[model samples]
Target: MKQPGIFISFEGIDGAGKSSHIEALAAAFRGQGRVVTLTREPGGTPLAEKLRTLVLNDAMDPLTEALLVFAARRDHLQQVIEPALARGEVVVCDRFTDATFAYQGGGRGFDLAVLSNLELWVQAVPTLEGDFVRNPDLTLWFDLAPAVAAERLASARVPDRFESQPAEFFRRVADGYAQRAAHAPSRFARIDAALERDAVWQQISQVLVQRGWLGAAA
Candidate 1:
């Protein structure tokens, strides 16, 4: 496949406020006359959404959770992401494999090598360019203190399994994301999630402009 579309992902801890801006960004793209596919990990396609519920609500082993997330990811890629990209639409996804590494590998102490293997197996796609692993062209990582995030999450909604984890777990997850960002500095734009919503959006808009994805007027 020759992909002409752009793939972007928003990532952060549960209360980092990344989820709140995804649709707004997608709307900006839409306003530019771009076709945007706004989707989420572990829950894009029908089957994946079912897996999402199980993964979020059920009590399971660390390895079991990782496996389930990757399974949903595979289905999501095949059923939603790939098709949207093939059609030259912008695909904006909320969370992805990064969350698996954060939650499972870092927080739960699963093997990083195992997570890497799953990423390759589940995301590698055959393209005219060769065997290409599906990865976001741009990843916006919302960075916030775990305590602040916990406070935000407290009033947002009922806590799910992951959300209910202790602050220490979230600290580890944040470290995991930091490691990933350090390893792939060019692909990630770390945003301060503690900022006001408008300020955060301005940061995002600046990135879009710098990337040539949006005009200055936008």
Candidate 2:
């Protein structure tokens, strides 16, 4: 069988703790001898990284933000993600298109229709399966209440543009994630981040095992 490798994306609001598990998951896959490309969106490439910096720091309207993000995504896909997948490497990314929908579309109250059009354009790529828009095979969304997330991020570090937003903004972002998950029930695995650390890891690992990405022993 022809294998195009696996793509997995981790998503959540800033304080949801999804970033903490990405390296561990990459290590788990690496232990199984899979080549894992652990990276992040609005990054993963030099040009995209520059774009990420602007997106995270500079003040801009929602439309500009959305455009910049999609532009970064296009570069990321072309330079990093697609090539890695074609080489049969597991591409574990910290964020992807879903983040745009959540942060810009939801948090900024941008028109979803415009974002949708941008998604359609930026995500379209030629794959082993033929021409289609590329998306994560699995998206692990760390679901946390806005209040809980706010409390967690309270003193972590100086806030970025997105991180500095009020809790109400995060609530909308969470709702956006819910909407996305509902639309693609098969692709999303909602991780309850309120659980203890061990429990949260267990949930993530079990889901990977269930999906045959990791061995039962992992």
Candidate 3:
């Protein structure tokens, strides 16, 4: 396979509008004549999609849950992400490894060292075929308060198990993302999600333009 030019990941607490934004962003990329592949972690393939249901459902243990998440990710990378990237397409992921680190490691208070070990093991899988994969090229972190996010979620029809978690749990996850962004500012763009929809899009648009992703005429 070949190396991709860019890999972006959108991450946020529940109801942060990442799904909507990722779709818009992919369209924007297409406008620039870029081939973009949009996928989600814990999904993007048949087996991984099933793992997503298991991970988000209410019956898995913490350790088992963490392992399952990584398992899906490994398959996602081999079958979907890496292949797209190797074809020189821009892979815009809905969520990525940071999710597990935040939700399971930080919110659930799992050992971070264990998370690292799991990543190492997964990356070494033979099917992975020696991908020099670092983290995402850019991580768009939609920053929003847990209370606000929960309020938005309440307006939606079905709340998943993660969304059904306590406010404090989501709060911890939000903080975890902030801390991660602080540690890797160059790779993250923390968007203020408390703003109105257009305002948030404007901010994102500005970032895209400044980064030479969106054209001045756009």
Q: By TM-score, how accurate is candidate 3? A: 0.92
Q: Show where candidate 2 strays beyond 4 Å.
A: 1-3, 127-130
lDDT scores of the candidates, listed in order: 0.92, 0.92, 0.84
Q: How well is each residue in 1-218 modelled by candidate 3, as lDDT tens digits?
A: 44346889998998887777888888888898889998998799999999999988858778998999999988888898877867888899998988888898778888888987887777553445664445788898999889989999998868878888999999889887877788789989989998888788887878888888778655
How far out, in Å, is residue 201 in model 1?
0.3
* lDDT by residue (tens digit), candidate 2, 165-188: 998899999999999999999999
Q: 1-218, model 1: which lDDT tens digit per residue?
A: 44379999999988999988999899899898889999998899999999999999998998899999999999999998999988999999999888888889888989999999999999999978788789999999999999999999999999999999999999999999999999889999999999999999999999999999987766
Alpha-carbon RMSD, candidate 2 = 1.4
- By summed lDDT, the worst window of 10 consecutive residues in model 3 runs over 125-134
Error of 3 at 7 (Å): 0.7
Candidate ranking under TM-score, highest first, comes to: 1, 2, 3
* TM values, all candidates: 0.97, 0.97, 0.92
- The better-scoring model by lDDT among 1 and 3 is 1
Candidate 2 lDDT score at position 40: 97
